[model samples]
Target: MSSRWLRPEVYPLFAATGVAVGICGFSLIRNITGNPEVRVTKENRAAGVLDNHAEGEKYKENFLRKYVRNKHPEIMPGINKFFTDPKY
Candidate 1:
C-alpha cells in the first residue's frame, strides 16, 4: 500500500502528534536528570549561610577571570594565578 503520510490531512495530524510526544519526552528527561535536590536544598533555610554567599561570589569572580584569561591570555597574565593562590 502507499504511505499513509502522503495524504495532506494525515500530515498535519502526524506532525502535531510528533510535536506533542517530543515535548512530553523532553519533560520526562528533564525531571529525571535536572537535579531537583539541589534546588530543594537551596530553598531550605538551614542550608543558607553567609560563608556560602561569599564563596558563591568568589566562585563567580574566579570563573570570570579564568574565562577572560582564556580569551586574552597575554593581557591577563596574572588573572587565573591569583585565584589559585591559597590566600583567598
Candidate 2:
C-alpha cells in the first residue's frame, strides 16, 4: 500500500527480498523436519538393504486403475500396456 513500494526502482529489491525470505523459510522448515542426510562411506556403501516386498506379497491394484482397466480398456492404449498384467 506504500507509495515507495509501488515505484519501479524498488520493484527488484522487493522481489529479491520476497524470494530470499521464501528460500530461508523453506530451508529452515526442511532442516527441522526433513529426513537425515546419508553419508556414503566405504563401510556403508554396500551395507544398505534393498527392500523387496514384491515377492512376498500380491500387488494390489487401486480402485481407479481397476475401474479404468475394466470399463475403459481401450482408453490410453500405450499406458494400458504397462497395466496389461492383472497383478500390476
Candidate 3:
C-alpha cells in the first residue's frame, strides 16, 4: 500500500517467476542425468530375499534360545507369544 515497488499486486508475479525458475532448473538437471542402474538384478532377487529372511529368523531363534537358557531356563522357544497358530 505504501511502497510502489513492493506492492501486494506484484506478489503473484514474483511467485510465478519462482515456480518457473524451479521447473526450468529441474528440467535442465533431469535432462543431463542418466537412468539409475539396479545393483541387485532379478537373478539375485528371490534367493537374496529368502536367504536374508532365513538368516534373520535363525539369528532371532538363537538369540532367544540363549536368553531363555540364561534367564528363564524353563520356557521353550516355540511356546512364546511370537508363535502363530498352525492353522494360519
Candidate 4:
C-alpha cells in the first residue's frame, strides 16, 4: 500500500518538482525582501539609482573573478588607453 508511493520511477519526478518549488520559493523570498540589484534610497527612489556597489559585489563573487583578478592585467586596458592616450 505505502510502497506504491515509493516507486523508483517517481524519484526523478519528485526531484524535479522539489527543484522547481525551491526556485519558486527563492524568487518569492527575494521579491519580498526587495531585489539587491535595484537600489532604492530616499534620493533615488523615484528614478532608482544604478547600484554599482551591488554590481561590484556580484562581480567579486563570480567564478571568473578569482582567476581573472590574478591573470588579467586590466579591466579593459586597450579601450582605456585608446580614450586616455593623448592625441597629438
Candidate 5:
C-alpha cells in the first residue's frame, strides 16, 4: 500500500474543500437553529419597546393638538391642511 495519504498536489485541494464544506455546514445549522440566547427575550423586549414608543407618540400628538387649540387656534387650519395635503 502507498504510504502517502494523498498525492502532494491533491492534498491541498482536499484540505481546502473540506474546510469549505465544514463552513457551509456550520452556517446552515446555525441559521436553522438561530441564536438561542435571544430567541424568547428578544421578541418580548422588542414588543415592549414598540408599545412604549407608540404610547409616547400618542401622548405627544395629544399634547400638540391641545397646545395648538389653546395657544394658536388659527394654526389648526394650517395643521389640518398640512396633514390632509396630497403630498402627505
Candidate 6:
C-alpha cells in the first residue's frame, strides 16, 4: 500500500497536484489578507507616525505606566520600590 504511493508514474501526478495546491493556498492567503503595496504618499505617512507618538506623549506618563497605575494599583508599591530603592 505504501509502495503504491511511490510508483514512478503516480509520483509526478501527486507532486504536480501538491505544487498546484500550495500555489493556490499561497495566493488565497495573500488575496485574503491584503495587497502588499503601501499606496499612501510618503510625506503624509511619515507625518502620521510622528503624530501618533506626539499624541501619546501628551499624557504625564507613557500609556503603560498609566495602565498599571489604574488597573493594578496593588503592584504600585513594588514598582515604586524597584525604581527608587538603591538595593538591587
Q: Which candidate tops lDDT?
A: 4
Residue 80's C-alpha lDDT in candidate 3?
57
Lowest summed lDDT over 10 consecutive residues: which window, candidate 6? Answer: 30-39
Best by TM-score: 4
The list of candidate 4 runs beyond 4 A from truth reads 36-88
Off by over 4 Å in 6: 35-88
Task: Tell me the tens digit of each residue's lDDT in model 6 across 1-88.
Answer: 9897787889789999999999999877754443323225566556543435443444436456776775645547788878889994
Estimate TM-scores for all models.
Answer: 0.37, 0.35, 0.35, 0.41, 0.34, 0.35
Clashes of 3: 0
Over the stretch 1-88, how does candidate 5's per-residue lDDT look in tens digits? 4657656888889999999999999877754455322235555546543435564555456544866666644647778978888886
Query: Pairs clashing in candidate 6?
Result: none
Considering summed lDDT, which 10 consecutive residues are worst modelled in model 5? 31-40
Q: lDDT per residue, candidate 2, 1-88, as tens digits?
A: 7886688898899999999999999777755443233324657446666444562232234345666675754758766877786755
TM-score comparison, 4 vs 5, better candidate: 4
- How far residue 9's Cα lies from its native spot in candidate 4, in Å, is 0.5
RMSD of 1: 14.4
The candidate, 1 or 3, that scores higher on lDDT is 1
**Candidate 6 TM-score over all chains jointly:** 0.35
lDDT of 2 at 51: 49
Off by over 4 Å in 1: 3-5, 35-88
Evaluate residue 32 in candidate 5 and report its C-alpha lDDT on the 0 to 100 scale.
45
lDDT string, candidate 4, 1-88, tens digits: 9899899999999999999999999877755456555444655566655656875576446566666766657778888788889972
Report the C-alpha lDDT of model 3 over 25-45, residue by residue, as the tens digit: 976664444212212455644
Report the error of model 6 at residue 64, Å: 42
lDDT by residue (tens digit), candidate 1, 1-88:
4766477778889999999999999767755554233334535546643345554555446545766764754556587667776775
RMSD of 4: 13.4
